[model samples]
Target: MSFLLEFVRDPLTVGAITPSGAALARVATAAVPRTGSPVVVELGPGTGAFTEAIQRRLAGRGLHIAVEVNPRFAQHLGALHPGVDVVTADATDLAAVLARRGISQADVVVSGLPWAAFAEHRQRDVLRAVVAALPPHGVFTTFAYLHSRWLPPARRLLTSLRARFDEVVVSRTEWANVPPALVYYCRRPVTEAP
Candidate 1:
């Protein structure tokens, strides 16, 4: 299925004008552990743009669960990435999603969600769930379009991210994506306790 078709059919859910490119994928997966049997949760892996990068990092040792709310995209993702434990569900229900798979905590969460396009409350809800699903050493990564970075919703999402994670590392602008964007790499603090 075409990425643009999904976006046109459901703009809010699809978000991006095009699937993310390799540059964005590399930056998004930068913090994902390349070693160890880590548990990964990917939010909105629309069209499997970030799936390849994440899967490579997992290297068959880790669990890669890609969660998509849209059934259309979810079906395509499951077929496209058979190794992934693809689920047709919302990111806000991270706990139940992982619990159903008999997993408790995720080592990393790489999101393809368009946080800049989402409502403030929706962003917070999904992120809070992500924080709760991860252990103290877990890492969360997501991207915000450069054009929308200063928007009220995007700004709010950043503030929410800082409050939840101990550190927030912004990647250099990725011009390879349809609309240039930068990745937000976040780490949970061992002592602060999310």
Candidate 2:
């Protein structure tokens, strides 16, 4: 499905005017562990952009699951990314989703969720789930449009991330994507899970 058509269907959920391309996908998942056979969960994998990079890094090792709220997009991901466990459910239900697969937690989460388009509470709900699903050393990665990085919603998301993660790093701008973007790499301390 085209990005424009998807955006027209739901602007806030779709978020971007274009599907994330190779450049954005690569940078977005750079923080994920390339080995360890870790379990990785991808949220909001529209068009399976990040899935492609993730699959390459995994190279048939570890478990890779995807949670997408949109049925249409979830179906598309299932069809396009064979062998991927695509669950058509909201990301806020991260724990339940992993539980269904008999897993207790994820070692890494790479989210394509449109943070700036969501309400602050919704963002917190989703992030809380992400944090719960991840181990203390787990990494959660997401991206924001370079132009909108300083916007109120984006700033708030950053603040939420800081409060949740012990360490957070921002990547250099990836100019190849539509409107350009940068990746946020986050890690948690050895603290209690929420």
Alpha-carbon lDDT, every model? 0.87, 0.89
Q: Over 4 Å off in model 1, which ranges?
A: 189-194
> RMSD, model 2, all Cα superposed?
1.5
Candidate 1 lDDT, tens digit per residue, 1-194?
A: 88888889889888977899998998999888878888889999998889999988778888899999989889998988899999999999899999998988899999999787788778877887888888888899999999999989889988888888889999999998879989999997333333
Q: Give the range of the ten consecutive residues with the poorest summed lDDT in model 2.
A: 185-194
Error (Å) of candidate 1 at residue 12 is: 1.0
lDDT of 2 by residue, 1-194 (tens): 77788889998888987889899999898876777888999999988999999999898989999999888889989999888999999999999999888999999999999999999889988988888888887999999998999999999999988888999899999999988999999998324423
Task: Name the candidate that leads on lDDT.
Answer: 2
Candidate 2 residue pairs in clash (backbone atoms < 3 Å): none
User: Which candidate has the top score in TM-score?
Assistant: 2
Of candidate 1, the 10-residue stretch with the lowest lDDT total is: 185-194
Q: For each candidate, give its TM-score against the true structure.
A: 0.95, 0.96
